[model samples]
Target: MPITDEIKKTLTDPTPLYALAGAGDLAYEKLREVPGKVEALAADRQGAQEMATAKLHEAQGLLAGAPAKVTEAVTALPTDLKVLQERAQGFALQQVARAVELAVRAKETYDELAERGKVVVDKARPQADSTQADAAQAVEPSDAAEPVAEPADPAEPIEAELLDEPPAPKKSKPRKSAPGVTE
Candidate 1:
């Protein structure tokens, strides 16, 4: 088909409209449960505040000791330039290793969350499809016009490729530290 005809067909298609209506219905249904959820969260606010306060104090304690630790490390530095260079190189290597580890962890976390989100959407898909079917049936032509095509199978998801799991990230080798330096 020509681009214009394809665009026109897409614009005229009722499937998207039904899908939108279905999404709206789902949002409305979820919104109905919000008030109860809000009340429950409000009831737990005191406990949350207490927990936050405890964490804040713990952080403050850690911060208070940080300066002393830094001073101690500085004072403990060896007088020899060669030894200092090795330690500095080891520290740099350790930082690089830490960065790699964190990056790996972040990728893993993102993939995990993506999988979880897909599962949630999959669970909601049937309800949305049912709603779309209901909406399509409820709508009727007001005047004689081109007959609308029958709705596609509601059980079939929109994009199969999009639903495919993403490839896992490649694992990197750990950095080797300088001699006599701990990880």
Candidate 2:
């Protein structure tokens, strides 16, 4: 429980103390990168200001053209509406045709799977019949007069099986070597 002088010296040894010293050196090197960060920050701020000015000019241009654009849209409204209605009707017909095509494809797939299932059943039918016939032949009476052992009583408890088993094997201990020279 007592701390000795040797323990104190080991804990205070400088050979193991350079981790913090190396860290301090690394921090000084990283501080050299600060000027680059400041430059980048200045460039970013200038870029953001230029982008804001350009967006303001673009917004002004749009504003100047707004009245003409509105007049053009109002004049062409009836023609645009008719075109949109025709497009919508065409889209509906196309969707119906696509649905019919998909239904036909699905029915084809179903029919193909049904045919495959029928082929598999036909191939397995003879094998199943032969196996059943073999099993029936095995169940027929045997000529040999071998004695049949009666089944153990189901009423017996589980402890009876455990009691009949042999004792478990013991773990072996390691042997001790003789003192002096080891080969």
Using lDDT, give the best candidate's number: 1
The lDDT per prediction is 0.79, 0.76
User: Per-residue lDDT of 1-183 in model 2, one digit per residue for the tens?
Assistant: 356978988887643334444444456778999999989988799788999999999999999999999999988777677898998999999999999999999777555555555555567779999999899878875668556544377666666567689999998998777897575
The per-prediction CA RMSD against the true structure, in angstroms, equals 30.8, 33.2
Question: Which whole-number lDDT from 0 to 100 does residue 160 have in model 2?
Answer: 50
Give a tens-digit lDDT track for model 1, residues 72-124.
99999788999989989999999999999999997775555555555556778
RMSD of 2: 33.2
In model 1, which regions exceed 4 Å deviation?
1-75, 141-183
Q: What lDDT does candidate 1 reach at residue 77? A: 75
Candidate 1, residue 103: the lDDT equals 100
Query: What TM-score would each prediction reach against the true structure?
Result: 0.39, 0.34
